[model samples]
Target chain A: MRLLLVEDELEMAAALGAALGRYDMILDHAPTLDHAMAALANHVHDGIILDRQLPDGDGLSLIPRVRALKSGIPVIVLTARGAVDERVRGLDMGADDYLAKPFAVEELLARIRALMRRSPDIAPITARIGNLVFDFDGRQASVNGRILDLPRRELLVLEALARRQGRTVQRSTLEESVYGYDDEIQSNSLDAHVSRLRRKLSETGAGVEIHSIRGVGYLLRPSL
Target chain B: MRLLLVEDELEMAAALGAALGRYDMILDHAPTLDHAMAALANHVHDGIILDRQLPDGDGLSLIPRVRALKSGIPVIVLTARGAVDERVRGLDMGADDYLAKPFAVEELLARIRALMRRSPDIAPITARIGNLVFDFDGRQASVNGRILDLPRRELLVLEALARRQGRTVQRSTLEESVYGYDDEIQSNSLDAHVSRLRRKLSETGAGVEIHSIRGVGYLLRPSL
Candidate 1:
C-alpha cells in the first residue's frame, strides 16, 4: 500500500516512513501544503496523513482541495491541535479520523488498516490458489499450513500475482506493487524477482507456478 | 513507467528527470553506486539509465549487481566513455544499449520505448471494448473512429480499466497504475478520477460504462 504523509516535521515523517515500511507500505512525504499539492497532482494515494499545521498553510485547508481531486480518499488529520473544537473542526472539514501529537505508531498503523478495511475497493482478506493460502490482511502466505517466509519484495510480488491467480498480472502492475518511486528499476527487475519467487515457491511445494506470458506479463496458476 | 538514473552530476540528473517526466516516466536518481544499490534493493523498475562514471565507482561495475537483482532489465549506459572498447565493454557488461554523453533526449526516449516494446511484459498496442477503441502505444482512446481527448490522469485510469474490460480490476492494482510513489493519495482520488472519466465517456457517447464492483474496484464493460 502507498500513502501520502503531509507532515512538516522531518523527524515525524522519517519515523512514520520507517514504521510504515515495515508493513511494506511506501510513503511519499510532503513537508508543506504546496508540496502535498504537487504530489497529489502527480500521484494517487490510498490514504493521507495530514498535519493541521504546515509551513505554507493549515493542513486542514488542503482537505478541500484533496476532496476536489479525490472525492473519497481517507484523510486522517494528525496535529498538535487536540482540543474538542479542533478535533470536531477537523472532522467537519472532512478529515475521516483525527489524532493528537505524540501519537503511538501502533495506533496510527491500526487506524490506517481500519481505514483500508472500510475502503470501497477492499479485496478479500484471504485468498487461496492450489495449496497456497494468502492472508492479505496480515501479509502472510503459506502452503498447506506451513508459513512461507519470503523477503518483503518477494511477498509483494506474490500478493499481487495471487490476487489475480488465474489471470495474467501485467509486468507494469507487478512493478508498481513491488517498487516505489524511491527505488531504481532496470527492465529486468520484475523478471528477476519473479524468477527468484518462482524458484522459492517450487522448492516449497507451493503446488502453484508463475508462468511468463512473453510480450505480456505473468500468470500464477495451479502447477498441474 | 519508472526508471533509475545513476549519474553523479546533479545537473544531468535534474535535466533527465524533467525530460522523462514529460513522458510520465518517473525517474529515481542515484548519485552513486551505493545509492543505486539501495534503490535496486527496494524497487522494481522498467529500465535503467546508467552513467559510466560516478563518485563512488564506475557505473559499469554496478551492471553485475543489477543483473543479479533483475536479470534481464534493460540497461542503457549513457556516459562520456564513447571509445569503441568502452562501448563494447558496456555491452559485454550486459548493457542492452549504449549511448555516448551529449546524445539527444529524443534518442534516449526512443531507446527506452524500443526496449519496452521488446520486454516480456509488453501489452498490446491497441484494444477495443464496445465502441471505445484504445491505442495503448500512442496512449489515446477513441469511439466511432474519433479520438477521445483525456487528461493524462484520466487517460491512465482509462487505459488501466479498458485494458481489463469486462473484468474486475482491484483498486490497489488501479492505484498502482495511476499513481507513483511521489503522489499523495487520499482514499477518494481514484473514485474522483473514475467518476470524471465516467462522466466524460457518457457525454462523449462512448457506449461503455465503468462499473464499480463495490468492495473490489471498477470494471469497464459495454453499456447496454
Candidate 2:
C-alpha cells in the first residue's frame, strides 16, 4: 500500500510516480510542503496525494496540518479547475479524498485506492468501557488511577456514546450531534446536554449511566 | 447528489439510469438486494452504486450492512473483470468506491463525482467537539452530557477521532486507520489498546482526555 506523492510538477511528479509505481505501491515522492513535512517526519505513508499547487507551500494549508498530524492519514486533494474554493476548502481541511486538475492517471490510481480502501476500518486508537478509557488518538484520559478534564463537547459526547456502545441516542440524536442538521435547535437542548452529562457523572464517581428513554433516546450504560 | 442504483441488469440498469439522470443527479432505480433495502428504507442516497454481480446478494455483504446502518453512506463496487481479488475483497468489504467492468461512462461519472464529493466534509452527520458529540450517519455518541458505552474497536476509534474534530492522531497514524499496509498486524496490540483506552475514560465519569505524545501518537483533548 504505502504512498505519498505531493507533486511540484517535475513532469507531473514523474508521470505520477511511474503511474502509481505500477500499482503495487510503496511510493513516496513529495515536491514540497517542506518535502511533505520531511517525508512525514520520516516514513509511514499508506495514503496522501496532496498538491493543490505547491513549490513550497499552500496545499490548503497542508489540509488542517495533515489532519492535525495524521489522524487517519488518507488525504487525497489535488485541485485546480478554477480552484472552486479548493473543493469546498479541501473537505473542510481533513481531506479523505479528492482529485481534480485534468485527472485520470487511471483516476489518480482510483482515488488512491479509494482512500486506501476507506482506511482499514480503523484499528487501535483505543476506546474501551468498564475500566474507562478513551485514548482518542492519544488525546489522553485516565480514570481509576486519575486525571481528567474532558471538555470538547464533552469529548464529542463521549465519542458519540462510545461509538454506539449500548445504543440509544435520540433527543433528536443529541441535537443532531452538536448542531449539524442545519442548526437552530433548542427545545431543552438535548436535555440541557443530558443534564450537564449527568452532573459530570455524579462528579467523577463514573458509575456510568446516562440513561433517559422518555420520548425514546440516550443510553451509555457502563455498569448502570 | 442523491444516488442509489443497485442493479440487476435490465439493460445495464436502464443505461445507467439514463446516464445518471443527465448528471444533475438523482436516481432511485433498484432491482434487487431487496430493491436495495427497500430503497434504503425509503430514500437517503448520496452515494451507493453496488452490483458486484448481485443476482440475489453478495454485494459485498452490503458493506457491513451499510456501515452498520449509516456511517456516512458511500458504497461503490460494480465489479466483473479479473475482479482483482474482487477488487481487494471489495475493498475489505466496506466498498467506498470501485468500478471495474469495461468501465467509463466518463469513468462512471468520475466515480459518481468521487462519491458525491466525500459528503461535504462530514456533512449533516451532526458533529462537534469540546464537549464532543458525533452523530456520524447516526452511529451516535455524546459526552459532556453523558452516554458512553463505546467498543466496536472503540467505535472505530471514536469514528476516526470524532470525525477529526481538532485532530492529532499518530501511532503509525492509528495503524493505517486499521491495518492496511498489507494487512498482517495481529497486534502492536496498539500499545495495549492505548493502555485499555486510558482506563475506559475514568470509568465513564467522561471528563475526557486521551493524550499521549511520548513518541508521537493519540489525542482526543476535547479542548482540555
Model 2 chain B worst lDDT run, 10 consecutive residues:
B119-128
Return the lDDT, model 2, position B179: 34
lDDT of 1 by residue, A95-149 (tens): 9999888899899989987776455343444455666777665677877667789
> Model 2, chain B: what is the TM-score?
0.31
The TM-score each candidate achieves on chain A is 0.84, 0.23
Q: Which runs of model 1 end up more than 4 angstroms from their true locations?
A: A41-44, A164-167, B1-224
- Per-residue error for A74 in candidate 1, Å, reads 2.3
Evaluate model 2 with DockQ and give the value. 0.03
TM-score, cand. 1 vs. native: 0.48
* Number of the top-ranking candidate, with DockQ as the measure: 2
Candidate 2 ranges with C-alpha deviation above 4 Å: A1-81, A84-224, B1-49, B52-72, B77-100, B104-113, B116-118, B121-159, B162-177, B180-184, B192-219
Tell me candidate 1's interface RMSD: 20.1
DockQ of each: 0.01, 0.03
